[model samples]
Target: MANHKSALKRNRQAAVRNARNSHIRSTMRTFVKQVRTAVATGDQAAANEALGRAVPYIDKAATKGIIHKATASRKISRLAKLVNGMA
Candidate 1:
């Protein structure tokens, strides 16, 4: 119950942004899971490919402010290390 018109508009905008951010976060999690699954399967090639796809998704998520920059970097680094260890 926003009394002011601007407050109402801001509330609407926040709802929209929340939905969009949720989708982005969900997609990022899916990508990360795919990479981890590939690694767990012990398929180096598949793991590498999945990691490749995941890196940009993670970077984009970070750039969009969905995730912290250091968190994204750590994720990418861990994925890379997993891929490297498989090789």
Candidate 2:
């Protein structure tokens, strides 16, 4: 437990940030999973749509420092490739 006023404030801020980041991270994972599910279902249109939605979330996550830029690029690339390679 933080005893000083500044330490307490910092703890509170950390809690808030943790909550917010958790939400963003979970939502990002959900979107990515949606893309993967669509791909696995072999629905090209749905996969493309899901990828469209997921890509921005991933980009935003990267921009916000939630994910690395290269990781974001790789994720987008793999998902796009799966969608594009679909017959």
Candidate 3:
């Protein structure tokens, strides 16, 4: 439904970006899930390690505009708290 040529090109670019963003977002969610699973299992060391891995991915996602920076910080904080709370 893109009439102009430039519009068509933009549509194509948007589609590509959408797919890439979706992949990155899915990966971020998976990383978060891993950290949560580790916490749920009460493995403090594993949870810490998973949180370490997850934070970078979250930051990258935020930088890439897939997620908000504050959201990323909040997620990292919550995960760290969960890990810390696991005696």
Candidate 4:
């Protein structure tokens, strides 16, 4: 428990940020899963479409500091490879 006013405010801010970050992370995972699901179906067009939609969300999450930039690049790279390989 935080006794000081500043500490209490910090706790509140942290809680809010935690919730927001969790939501963003969950949404990012959903998008990534969509891309993977599309890829697994072996439909090139659908996979490509999903990848296209997913990349921006992944990048945005990285830029927002929810995920690391290299992690975002790796995810995009892997998904792109999967989509391209379907060709």
* RMSD after CA superposition, every candidate: 0.8, 0.7, 0.8, 0.8
What is candidate 4's lDDT per residue for 20-71, written digit by digit as tens?
A: 9999899999988998998888888888888888999999999999999999
Q: Which regions of candidate 2 deviate over 4 angstroms?
A: none
Task: Order the candidates by lDDT, highest first.
Answer: 1, 3, 2, 4
**Runs in model 4 with CA error above 4 Å?**
none
Alpha carbon lDDT at 85, candidate 1: 90
Work out the TM-score per prediction: 0.95, 0.96, 0.95, 0.95
Q: Candidate 2, TM-score vs. the true structure? A: 0.96
Q: lDDT by residue for model 1 over 1-87, one digit each (tens)? A: 898999999999999999999999999999999999999999988898899999999999999999999999999999899889987
Better of 2 and 4 by lDDT: 2
Name the regions of candidate 1 deviating beyond 4 angstroms: none
lDDT score at residue 86, model 1, on the 0-100 scale: 84
What lDDT score belongs to each candidate, Candidate 1 first?
0.94, 0.92, 0.93, 0.92
- Cα-based lDDT at residue 24, candidate 2: 86
Looking at candidate 4, what is the lDDT of residue 63? 94
Model 2 lDDT per residue over 1-87, tens place: 989999999999999989988888899999999999998888888998999999999999899888899999999999888889997
Model 1 RMSD in Å is 0.8
Model 3 Cα lDDT, one tens digit per residue, 1-87: 999999999999999999999999999999999999998988888888998899999999999999989999999899888888888
Please report the candidate that would top TM-score against the real structure. 2
